[model samples]
Target chain A: DTAVSQTPKYLVTQMGNDKSIKCEQNLGHDTMYWYKQDSKKFLKIMFSYNNKELIINETVPNRFSPKSPDKAHLNLHINSLELGDSAVYFCASSQEERKAFFGQGTRLTVV
Target chain B: GESVGLHLPTLSVQEGDNSIINCAYSNSASDYFIWYKQESGKGPQFIIDIRSNMDKRQGQRVTVLLNKTVKHLSLQIAATQPGDSAVYFCAEVTGGGNKLTFGTGTQLKVEL
Candidate 1:
């Protein structure tokens, strides 16, 4: 079974289009996170939810919003995506301070 | 302003040879550190981890060494194989928040 899964493995959209990436984890973890990996392969934390509560919000712009319906799910919604939005979005989940398990990641490309 | 960074962006090694990837962090408060391996088109997979309390931890064929005084960490792989070719990343968690900060990845190419 896939412990952490993200939908839309690949996404290509226009410059002004909006998109949403879904992430779900079956690990029963309390902490769920959204990360952005740039072309340089630098992983940066965008948002984190602990038990459906917003915990970590990085310097990301307001165009990106993360919603957590529950502890098992965290979805990212991007409004008016731009060229700079092109990157790989990854979903991860962890229990307490233990190691985190990451999903396959969704590649987002804005033309 | 704390960040984790890698020294070398890429490393090439021969099959059956040992490989070492180095990382440095500016946060001295970080107590937990982990090493992750990411293949092409895949997410980062956990390989090994070490805490500030310990200087070294060994896994199947991977070893993680942490130096708290210098805030440096290293991952050593024994008998690297072609399947081991991937990007290796080092992450740190601080203040018990469990938020992992990943360093720049190091691409490891194992040549036969």
Candidate 2:
């Protein structure tokens, strides 16, 4: 069974478009996070949630919004996509403050 | 600003040989460290972790060594195989925070 899973392994969209990537975790973890990996393989934190509450929100643009309807799910919605927003997005979860388990990743390309 | 960095960007190793990847961090108050492996087109996978109280930890064929004095960390893999080829990252958590800051990463290529 997959501990953390995100939908749309690949997403290709044009600029000025709006899209959403969904994530779910079955590990019953209290914390979930969204990370972006650039072309150079640099992984940076974008957003974090703990028990359906927002915790960490980095310097990401206001175009990106993350929603957590429940503890098991966190969805990222990007309004007015930009070419620079093209990157691999990963969803992860961890219990307490320990190691995190990541999903395969969603490669979003804003063409 | 706190950051983790790797000495080498890429390391090539022959099969049957051991491999070592090194990382350095700037955060002295960081209490936990972890190593993750990421293959092509995949997310980072947890390899091993070490708490500040421990200097060394082992799992399967991998061993993690942490030196608090120099704020350095290393991962050693025994009998490196072709399947072991991937980008390895070192991450740290400071002051018991849930945020994990990752290093630049090292690409390990195991040659046959």
Give the TM-score (vs. native) of candidate 1. Answer: 0.97
B31-98 per-residue lDDT for model 1 (tens digits) = 78989999999999988888879999999999999988888999999999999999999999885866
**lDDT (0-100) at residue B35 of candidate 1?**
93
- Model 2 per-residue lDDT at A13: 98
Off by over 4 Å in 2: none
Query: A11-107, model 2: which lDDT tens digit per residue?
Result: 9999999999999999999899999999889899999999999999999999999999999999999999999999999999998454898999999
What DockQ was computed for model 1? 0.74
Clashing pairs in 1: none
Question: Per-residue CA lDDT of candidate 2, range B1-112, in tens?
Answer: 8999999999999999999999999888787899999998888998999998899999999999999889899999999999999999999986467788899899999989
lDDT of 1: 0.93
Model 1 chain B TM at 0.96
Q: What CAPRI-style quality would you assign to candidate 2?
A: medium
Q: What's the residue-level lDDT of A103 in candidate 2?
A: 97
In model 2, which residue pairs have backbone atoms overlapping below 3 Å?
none
Q: Quantify all predictions' global Cα lDDT against the true fold.
A: 0.93, 0.93
